[model samples]
Target: MVEVNQFYLKFEANPDRYTLSDLNFCLNHGESLLLLGPSGCGKSTLTYCLNGLYPRELDGEMRGEIVINGKPATEYRPGEISQQVGVVFQDPETQFCMLTVEDEVAFGLENIGVPHEIMEGKINHVLEMVQLLAFKKSAISSLSGGQKQRLALACILALEPSLLILDEPTANLDPIAKKDVIHTIQSIQEKTNCSLIIIEHQLDGWTELTERCLLLNRKGIIFYDGDIRDAIAFKLDELQEQGIWLPKITQYLLKKRLKTEQKLPLTVKEFEEKPFSLFGNEEVNEGNNLPEAGLPYIKASHISWKVGQQPIIQDISLTLYNGEFIAIVGANGSGKTSFSRILAGIQRPTKGSVSIKDRKLGSWKESQLREEVGYVFQNPEHQFIANTVFDEIAFSLRLKMENEAVVKEKVQAVLETCGLLQLQHEHPYALSQGQKRRLSVAAMIVDDQPFLLLDEPTFGQDASSNAELMGLLQGRYESGATIAMITHDMELIHDFATRVIVLHKGRLVADLAPTELWQLPIEKLHKWQLALPIQVQVQNCLKKEGDYAAQSS
Candidate 1:
């Protein structure tokens, strides 16, 4: 249904540098292809070319041929092409154009000139397919990130395009929400005969659904194009170095030096169905070695925040000790970000109060507060205040009136640590998603504040960068920094957080150690729209099988 031949592309400003070159691929009707590569490798750029958003909207030079449904893609107008190819972008908020869920889903249908009668049915059907029927009348502003993502998919599905493209659809979602989106996509594929092209970093839930995989190199060249299983099993190390994610099961096999000749598991269920000698033999000590309770460095007492008539956070009380890694997690709109803002003095609470080191947060001067606590917003762009990456990181040091030699040394160290040295002179907005995240962190941590707070720190990061960034954060924490992070990555919470705080409906629901939190009922966790990490899920599955075997014996 889709074909590309000897494709080459270079942006207008950089004529000598080809962002994408010699790209070639074809997809038949009802087939699914997974696109995998590191950040800034032209994965999203390729999607733009395929969706007709490249040459027309984004100024760029292009070559070769791209045909959709036996017709040259270049021949069709953007409006006409929308009927054949539908895309659900990575950021759902950017795709919204209407106030209500029903209107947003129907907007695309109306644009295509569908009859009012059929549009009603199409809108309702797609909304139901995505399990958003109950929210059909709700305002888009009130929906959670996960709900917004479903709404985006509903809009695309209503058009019933022959080819569906999803780029990093699960990047910003929690695990349970991620699963919900994954299931909706699978259901759509089963019901409709459409080709699928997914550009994603999360590989857990996509293995079984994808038939083929296309791996792109750093230069945007197609490195591997073949069966999904073969691409993963044979090219595991290569993919890992490319910053692409591998399934946990595959990673385990690789670590154990086990050969995947005739047997390779894609999903956890597949791995469980097959017996392995290595199962249930190792003692995995699961515990967070938190220090004894000390004097509270920061405290929040009965804090509440409301917007007009709606209360977002209510009566939340907590104490954060010095030199501890705390993870604040919850479902979308559960007030995680609101609470973080309150802690950082960005948003004042409607009731109650917060204090830093026995001093009321409000009493601290802006300059003093900034020096004592460093904050990285969920959207990195919000915190950026300089033209170039170099200046952004050096801004803090320069404000302190440090000597040129000292400022240069500190800024360069942070740049190298966060892998932004090469991008020092580049504009912050021009960098890739991963690069932006690194720059944001580099800028905030340059001053080495005593307390650091980050919202969704690993949102757009790839594997290698994630490890590198987290390692840097760990070093900072060890150097007597008190860290609090609002994240949806359960793996990060499990591995790093000394204490896990769960919020639900604007209240502190649970505050416990990572191991203790996991021991709670799965249904209870689901109530907050949370999920276990892949490693924890695997352990639970193995434990259940062992219990059954022992009972039978």
Candidate 2:
């Protein structure tokens, strides 16, 4: 068990004010605690506090105290903390310090000097628990977003701590992997009866597993605490008003204001079994061709790309019209990223050609190609090559050796559009994850390209940041920009995508609209390792069973 007494945490970045202020929490054995909050709410910082990173590794000021199993957490060495409390960070990629999956999984155990003789069994057990046994020797760099997450969980479980704290363990994973990881983590918690604390924004995925929920506001004080299901159902409106993500199915019922059942479902499976009077056809027309508009702005013909003797993309043919927003989804290593790079002309296909406005891509000058197509990478930090936000955004404009006045005006204009105007002087590296994503994105958008290819644009962003990015993209689409995104966030496709493309084993499987996608067999989506959002699934189910028609009758 762990207890925090009137905890106050501050940092040198702000000479005053605790990131988490006057907060008190108590966690007991065999109970799972969910920490929910908006972006920059200090939920993650609070986790660091309980695990002794607050005043130590993070170099911050700490008041009050945290006691774990009747001992001060502050007194423990990091290694000691690792034994008592295992932590899986928000970004699985950043936490990996090893070259291979096996090495990373065994890292903490080896650090604590868990004997080599006893290491194999522990490693195998956790890998099996997290369903990463087959990938034991895989390189960390080659893993899919989901595989990387599973490995992170395996690494912490190998430590076998008395408590497990996961910081958004599924943020980068696809929905299937997210659900699998969530299920596996809950099983481990129930079987071992270890104290569990999970900090996550995707609420619905964890509903079936959560026991106690703690809602932390931006100020870091607990706004609500009690039974997970009851609290969510009780304060559903308030949580939604704060722009927080509730379970998808719950939100569906809440929209209708249906007050039936003691508790609304927090997941797809639970909702499918419950009876309802509302037709699934609340807003969509039946049997109509997905909206059609305009002509192709960019087209590819028989494109085949290769690296050495291996084909990264095979016989890809596609068309992107003006002002269209498309999501390209596939499992990691399925060539979605490679395909994006090709579309942006960042990678050349060995065979065939890409046409932009009836001209071959190879015919365009480098400057002309860049002016027409902009590619944003998955790692935002890597894209930043400048000192400050202003310089980063201004770097390309300056590269043209434009006049100083022109450069300043263009940079300032983009800064305002990307919401980084206030942080113009701040080091790009020093900004928060959300800010860094926006800054990097701003650089690409400032050029005002007609076509954009983005790789995992929303992977690590907070809800607010993701929404802001979506709105910006939507505005651009309305103003005649063709946008293609490679991503793992399925909800993003369900809500914002005008078209969905699924790739499997380096081949295009399906390309259709969101409404049309719901009509396809669910198994096909799963076979491609794609996950449909819960509402889409529920809607599909209701339609198939004539539940909607019955309601109308």
TM-scores, all models, native as reference: 0.94, 0.88
Q: After superposition, how far is residue 31 of candidate 2 from its true place, in Å?
A: 1.6
lDDT tens per residue, model 1, 1-553: 9999999999865678898999999999999999988877888888888888877876668999999999988999768888889998867787888999999988888887899977888888888877789889888987766678778888998888899999888776777777888888888888888999998876878887885899997788998999868887678678888888777666655655655456577788887787644453444446575667766899999999987777899999999999889999998778888899999988999999999999999799999999999999876888888999999999999999999999999999988888888779888987777788899999999998999999988877778888898999899998889999989888788778999899999999999888888888999999998887666776777777788878999
| Clash counts for all predictions | 0, 0
* After superposition, candidate 2 runs with Cα above 4 Å error: 233-238, 257-263, 278-293, 301-312, 348-355, 358-365, 397-425, 544-553
Q: What lDDT score is found at residue 248 in candidate 1?
A: 63
lDDT by residue for model 2 (1-553), tens? 8998888887776656567887778888877888887666787788777777767777567789899988999888766877889888776777899999999978888888899998999999999987788878877876666678788889988877888999878776666767788888888887789999988777766878875788877566777888767767677666655546666677666766666656777777776676645333444222224457678788888878776666767888988787678989877667887777777788888887888888888899989999889888876887899989999988888887889899899889878866678779878876655567788789998777888888877655555567778888888877888888887776677767788888877788888887777667878777777876656665567666675657778
| Leading candidate by TM-score | 1
> Looking at candidate 2, what is the lDDT of residue 317?
91
Candidate 2 overall lDDT versus native:
0.77
